[model samples]
Target: MTYQNYSLKQLQQIDAAHYLHPFTDHKELRDIGSRMITRAEGPFIYDSEGTELLDGMAGLWCVNVGYGRTELAEAAYEQMKELPYYNSFFKCSTPTPVLLSKKLAELAPKNINQVFYGSSGSESNDTALRLVRHYWAIEGKPEKNRIISRKMAYHGSTVAGTSLGGMDGMHQQLGGAVPNIVHVMMPYAYELALPGESDHDFGLRAAKSVEDAILEAGAENVAAFIGEPIMGAGGVKIPPASYWPEVQRICRKYDVLLMLDEVITGYGRTGEWFAAQTFGIEADTITTAKALTSGYQPLSALLVGDRIAATLVDKGGEFYHGYTYSGHPVACAVALKNLEIIEREGLVERVKTDTGPYFAQMLKRISGHGLVGEVRSVGLMGAIEIVKDKATKERFSPVGSAAVAIRDHAIANGMMMRATGDSMILSPPLIWTRATIDMAGDRILKALDLAERDLRNA
Candidate 1:
């Protein structure tokens, strides 16, 4: 009776009058209207107008198991009916979160054996910042509280998350960031690699920046070095293969804790349970959310390593930080069922063996396009860089305009995607088949052709 009773126009009118969206321009949005997504199933979403588009961004880089999972819904319903809401505080506990935490610990890296719950990636990152600092303080190094992040990294949007991240726009609007969180260069070989530099060499150089930051901070002051394993919101900037191991080695050398922000890359997104496993990274903390329950529920788990967990337990002081919904029973029930669904369907195995490789091969269809500067992909996530000059990899003036045009054209052609800077990003659901890949590629090629014509005309 909700959307059924309200007309699309009426909903849009009400939305414009009352709603506020994140990372949106309100004035510009008021000029237009919100595109109401009425329903979704498999890998497609239907708008209020009944136009269906293949979802290529996986509902903001979550929804790993895709949409319309009845098992997850039923799990939530059963949990709610049995135990609607309860706080994991005051010496109380819940069975669902307790069981979910054990499942997560089994899935996480061996050293990361404990779980801390929150409601979103932002909250988990906040917890991560607090946890690492707390760990150092417990170990009697309160001054070792500095965090090293990468430029263009997307941690989350909370004040602590924003400060831990290194986006220029977010920082400008942030007014001020948390202190001692230094930013280093990202290991993006496409732009950062020098002429005649091998990918392996470029990776080492990028990893060296962490060492430099540690040395500058005297190692005694730096607490942890945080980064997304695949840099998802940073245009899926996949680093060179040699980057992570070397960063891990440097962190070990400097005793700087490694924090992996896998909010977008966790829960089989990168063809593994976690991208830390994908790259053999031994991070002290892994911040995960988004696809944890395939977007069926809001939940985040900060996987803490043994070293930190043991110290905190031995210190025996209350952490003095936790959310009211830290371990909500309903969300935990949904997540357990969601993980079961992922495992039962062998979705991760499919991505690792079949779909992921096919996606890499299929993306070649647009690799040679006139407007495409370079194409890159890992697993199901991909990026197509739009450029004015192919030889020089020079982008068009008014940055992001061409990619935005391509994105719009792609959506109009029934292929949903996102544009970040001058690159078109695609992180489709894990359940996509070869046929879905072909369909998405065809629509994107059409979009590229249309955008090329418009750009050349201008």
Candidate 2:
């Protein structure tokens, strides 16, 4: 049975005693208690207290088709009854996984036709890292194993994923990460751009950092350069137009594989099936998750491009990596239905044509608020920089504190947004409409006004 029989206080007591959350401070959590999300529908979630919250972050940037999708539920149920569980090992395979892989190939970029499944983005990323290195090893260049990533880029939380990522805080706790991963400057123009430098110039300069890393590591020693098309957990930092093309050019020039972590940007987050297509990146591999099953089930697919797939098939044998839940039948079934809904409803096109543009326009209404330094968006993904001085783009001291305050205020006002450092990020459901955007705007503006007052009083 669910927690429905227990009182809210009882549930909280049990949770604080036994449950441990990811990336959370248990001491502080014990003091405040957990917010119980009892149910969700459309773009709104309901807590145990019966408070209705507009999920502006789309339940950790996954719930693309929104909550309460009965079709996805039925898909999982049917699959469970039919082929509950099976392993692809020992020459055994399941029909659901096979069919889902075919569907994913059709939806992925032109060159990406093969898929390696896992249970989460972290697992898929681990698969990508191993596969890329394995490809080089099989090609008789075992020395070419170093990977270049970006500072502040969020890939996932696994050892390999964390090593490939550039978050300093996560690295501090890692004690020791996987070796041979290097980080370069990200294409974040707002903070990194130099005095009087155009966006185009900054992008080129950022891309040059990749080339510099390759040269530093010796191009022959570098296996691949991996990055998110739009830095997602890195505050939805969208790169300038000149950024990706130059990055692609540099990787191509050096013959280094270009891997993309689209865990947060895949499945129509950027108005396309994949952000690589949106940004014109000819990636050799694309790691995807989160929205693949719309968070209804845990699943991730590492879309393998022809170049790497061909090498692995032709040269590499028994590369030796995968998970038990890799291509899980139920998860794959849910994902297929989720994709069907996305296509049937034309959610991708909707984000591209209608709601995406309107969402940006609505954000502009509050961009001039006292607490807002800048507001930016692409498709349904957005970020609002909170600052102490608007003119100088000066942030409040002790980064992330001010954002936490603003986020609390936003949640109390019935909006669910994420505070990543000093940036308020939003990646609402693809199903969110103009009306939902309006509601979110009103609540956000209220929170901003409250935050301005709170900061001034402090």
Candidate 3:
């Protein structure tokens, strides 16, 4: 029986009874009920009640090519009919994965030419962690396995990914985390910068924290430092211009491998194939997913640099790590088609030259609102910091509550944005045009005004 036969109430009841959603509070969800998204097209999603919402978060930071992409659907259908379920195990190979690998290699940075497949960013990050440690062990340094990450930086939700990540809330839920993963200060100058500190100076200082960790742990004990190029789930925290170059220098100085988790920033999100290229980072490994298939299918690729790939090739030995759907043919096919659409439509270039700059300028119109402390963006990803006092930059009493109010207001006003603590974030589809940007800006400003009024009354 398809869900289309059921009423919205019936569907909600069924979902509450059987479905356990990720990162959700079940009891709270049951109280509120789910807003059933029946369908989506372009950059908007429609509820079962037929309310249209301009998706500002791109369906949880994916869906780059927008919705209703028949090309992706057709590609998946064709691949499924031809070779639906084949495992890349026991010396078996598929044409789609092989072709996708070549395409990804051509698109990725020059150093990253090899790929390891997984179903999601979390799984690929697990692969990256294991692969880097395995590389160090094979090179006759078994003890060099500690990884340094940034506090509040999100990697994923798996045990290793959560441990590599530095979210205190996630760590609290985790009974215990993987050992030897240390976290340092992030390069978020808005909150962390000292009074009168320059962005460049703060960036260097943040990079220095990585060096300090290596020194404290002994460089020989540190294998790699993994981080998101732009901390997406951690409030779209884009580092300063000087951050990545300094971090790269530090990693090179201590012979530490630089791992980039580009789950949210990959594809056309950053006006480039990968955030590593957007930021000029020379990463040893890049864990990518999300927009790889524009959320049409689940697929992840861990792009390995030449050095690591060469080491694995030269010092050949089974690393003993893989998933059942490592290189799923259908997912790869959808991804290939998604990449084609991104390229065919010139979405990346559009984001780079036309929409990105316009979006930033549009966001500035709302920056002067009393409730917005700061507005920051890179490419299509953006953040608006909610503040209680404009001059003092004081946040609301409960940290995230203000952003929730604003997000609710935004959704009520027919736009979808995300709330991370006190920051309202946006990662709209690459297909959004100047008109879409204007609409979003107006909706956001209205939401901000509503939030400010409500907060003042409260």
Candidate 4:
């Protein structure tokens, strides 16, 4: 565990020899040295080469408590000393999980009364799939089993979650996705809009796609429709105002459960505690993770509403679905502390009243930029779509590479960000300030300028 004796070159060689990274091309990664970060503190990371980089993506859109919170660490240590691990299965229970569930119920969307624990966002969503199917089975309508998701939405990487997620690349790699899962067009007005299409009309048209899909699939066989409120990792596409309301009405018209995947948008990222609240959508089930522990520990939760819980309890005797580490005490302890920090610091309120507005205003400045087509944001989550032509909104011919170059340029300028397709995305730590925002905005623009110059030269 001692890293002091090793040089950076030695570490890189060891990594190349032994490590297999996730969501990476192993052969290409071995050819290029991976930047090994040794430590992180307060939104800044120090790599093995001792270079500091400001983390603008908030460590994969988690780490909302920022980095290096000793309180969270101490909380985990304390819980471990008392009890390292325990399962929620077989009537076994722990205080931490029980307490965390209560807290989540109090904090999550209204009418949601029960919590099911998992180890990651993926597992939580996978749990959602099972619960919906189970609930439908309990209702004596096992035929109602199809699920609908939005195109380009990112849920998680597990079989069911990935199938529910609408990334075509991920789906194609996995081959035939989990049967009964379908996707509708994302309400991306800027990209999918017809010539002279108004935002309102476009939103209604987009929202109706769900109803159309349900009817196509036969509503009697459709169980649930899942989507992220702000569609994170799908180029940070924020839907139009008319979208969620119409979507809600459609879900109700059929007896389909409306599940909101709040994995990224939960815990103050969306200014509201959950994106469902922000968008005024009534969700029968909600999946949350990431900032649940602020990346201090691996934990996730699936909050079940009263109707679903009642069905499960009334018809089911023994529940067969749960992870071995579903309610790990240490993870629960860390999550408790993370929630406490957010509450005590008033981070969510600050995001709602001050930081969210400041961030949005700063983002809006890019709206008039020639290379930028749109600057969309809600609370701390945002994206700037890079366009080749302003009026026509023409994207780069080579596609996603230009955005990747902008991301690299940002990193070179000592900032961390993620870009997808032609969109440069930002999801700063919830503890971010006006000063940090100003610096990050400048750094982002600098990267865009470099990308623009490179495109011109090419």
Candidate 5:
């Protein structure tokens, strides 16, 4: 119960020497040391020194019900006491996972009824890739293994997830990536739109790229198209209104399966149970994690559509892919409780009707800031573009410097935000009320104002 035997500085030293953080530059982290987040509560996190911050990223876009929920903690405790650890293998079964699967089926689109579990979103995506490929092979079309993803689109960091993604820097390190995966232009109208293209037209053109990829690969060679409803880590890039429907039409035209990566947007973050429902699209597989347990436990459930499930069952063979912690009992228990909390508190409906709109309106009030080129949001996820010249939408000399500056200032002013490239992104907890939004707006304005002075002077 006592972890403070080492001082804060000592803890930092130990961390630098031993802990290798994900997606971190170790040398830089060693030099700066990590900011020790010691505790959290509803919509706020506190550092080791007890400085409170409005949690803007929702603990990496999870923690939807907010932090410090005793019910989730109690659920984990009870499940562990009952059935601590049991592998969902060898025809073994667990009550929590089975019940959780039923609940997920109810929440998911009508066609999606089955669930496959993993500990993280990355693992879920890997399972999805293998399973889809397996589906075609069972259907007697082994050559239909190619996948279509978008440039700057983030799936996950696992080998298959990365290969299926289109981040250039990630690919530079990813030697001998999973072959047959192709990337197309994302539906990001701010940059990819033509000189004077309408948002709807740009969306159509973006969807066309996927069709072109399918055509180039000859449809028969393509397996599925994977995408986030609204791009998350790649700067909360919300596609145009016309994008998903057009993309779905194209995918159906070619008979290509649709895979939705809802790792960030799942579990009511998009004001719906799934972003697919929010976007009015149906996916063959929905890769979900994150908010399932509100970060209280690590769990992911790949919602499998009936069509895919039917094929796997009718074809009759072991899928030959899964994780040791698949359908983990404790995680499933926590997730069931987490979902119950969201439903009982009406968090999803609140996001859809109240706070989501209020948050968007409040964001607009700060859009007049000189550093802001544009502000956009969907549900609780949003982004603020940091531009050197608002009229031209030009970024600072160094790509991420301005956004990082603003991020640092935001943190200093009691708000936690992430700087992705030239934009500051926010995915706050669903529990945030109008007061929380107003408080966040104040901190954001302060951060922008402070960063603007520093950027101009430099």
Candidate 6:
């Protein structure tokens, strides 16, 4: 029952027997045994085996303040001792919620003043779905209920969130996607662009697809379009310059509400408070989690622009929506303190001018390797696509196995990275420095080398 009572082997045995992990191939994990993380501090996690691993993915793209922040812990402790369980429902609210909301309004895009709290990114996204549809319904436009998302864009794992997301694998297992949710082409320049096409032209063409989908579905039937600014879990895809601007224009032309899903790209991940600013898109509502509390506590929020909030309020009361733990006190307190630290430390500005560019430069070196087909980065988020034939951009067998191997190699080499298909991604903590990146690059380069050698030998 105690930490010292179980040896590593015993812990692994117990985990294999009892633990059911998300987004994991259980059988494969059982074969390999879990990499039990025991402790962490400042962008590094120490395994049960006492191996120090650089967290290249920022603990599921959260943990913006990095690991082991006693400040956040103390804040949570203080709030829990005083008012941990109060809800924002039934004429009851807490100071944490009020303070966090003010901080979010200050941090979010202008005109976005309302904040609806949730416990996870998934729940926040689900809230967006309900809110958007409800907005349309309240306007007596029940027919306007379609939500458009781009292919490969990750929203979350909940039923409505997965439906809003465009991953076919996640959808296929869930009895097809939810109805009225349409998918448009994602602007992945490396994979989707044609040879000799200009980035601008490609961007415009891709943006037009959104309009096309709206037309095909009939603009009157579309409720909103949701997207991540950099498409985090979809491989840290940084859309070309013209993509988002045109998409925003199209959304306006079609009278579709834009919902920027900043679950990963929000906070300081993209060198900006929200990716919408990074891309210059004006959203009617925005979904955020992850870095809100830097993963120190469980929290998420749906930021409703003044426009949406006004309409919803005028339309009716008894919104008949929201989670029980929405706006939980402890979560809000931790998030407030976390944001304060991010501001006091100038983490967002640091990402914009320093660590982000340095990280990009470091990643670029890893490209041009025979196995590296592409390297794409924006702010502190990026991905290196592994390939079997770089000349033709041919991906490896089993589609994403090469990237998986590269990730495994990185893990074995004391760095943690994520692989989505053949794309190996790195989204280190926003506070990561050039020194930390250099250390990560060492592991990444080794992973690339090992992947290349293994593929060739196989």
Cα lDDT, all candidates = 0.93, 0.93, 0.95, 0.90, 0.94, 0.89
Off by over 4 Å in 2: none
Model 5 per-residue lDDT tens digits across residues 53-118 = 999999999999999999998999998899999999999999999999999999999999999999
**Each prediction's TM-score against the native?**
0.99, 0.99, 0.99, 0.98, 0.99, 0.98
Instruction: Give the number of the best model, judged by lDDT.
Output: 3
Model 5 lDDT on a 0 to 1 scale: 0.94
Evaluation by TM-score, superior candidate among 2 and 4: 2
lDDT rank, highest first?
A: 3, 5, 2, 1, 4, 6
Please give the lDDT score at residue 42 for candidate 1. Answer: 95
Query: How much does each candidate deviate from the true structure in C-alpha RMSD?
Result: 0.8, 0.8, 0.7, 1.0, 0.8, 1.1
lDDT of 6 by residue, 1-458 (tens): 68778899999999999989999899999999987899999989999889999999889999899988999999989988997697678888888899889888988889899999999989999999998888888888989999989999898999998999988999998996678998999998888998999989999988889999999999999999898888888888888899999999999988999998998988888788888888888899899998899998889999999988999777765788888899999989999899999999999999999999999999888887889988988889999988899889888789999988888888989899998888998888987999998888888998888878898898
lDDT for model 3: 0.95
TM value for model 1: 0.99
Q: Where does candidate 1 have its weakest 10-residue lDDT segment?
A: 1-10
Cα lDDT of model 1 by residue, 177-220, tens digit: 98889999999988899999999999999999999999998999
